[model samples]
Target: MSGAVWDAGRCWRCEADDVPVIWLGPVQTQEHGAGPFAACEPCIRRLEQLVETHHMQADRSA
Candidate 1:
């Protein structure tokens, strides 16, 4: 999640509208309009946890 921002809009991850959102990276799916994808706080935290877990696994493997 690069260049993330806290805002109020639809969360691309959970599809929850009228809530707080953080704009992040590009929207890979064609279903979305343009880039600068939006995600809620919970989603961001989950993603951060996933990334941390992945890094830990990679470090152990290395």
Candidate 2:
């Protein structure tokens, strides 16, 4: 969950540019293959929620 703050960059999820970003980690895509991923604050929060929800569901299933 460690990240580096960026003043301006493109978000991998929403494709937003020229905004504050958090450089999280690497990601893979069919088009670009694999590289570092950056996301805006909102996208980052959304992704964190998704991961938390997924883990909660998994725990319930277990």
TM-score of each: 0.73, 0.78
Off by over 4 Å in 2: 1-4
Poorly placed runs, candidate 1 (over 4 Å)? 1-4, 30-34
Give per-residue CA lDDT, model 2, range 1-62, as digits (tens): 45455668889889998878887888988897989888998998999999999999999999
Write out the backbone clash pairs for model 1.
Answer: none
lDDT for predicted candidate 1 compared with the true structure: 0.85
How many clashing pairs does model 1 include? 0
Which has the greatest TM-score? 2
For model 2, which pairs clash? none
Q: lDDT score, residue 45, model 1?
A: 94
lDDT per residue, candidate 1, 32-55, as tens digits? 776778889998899889989999
The candidate that achieves the highest lDDT relative to the unseen native structure: 2
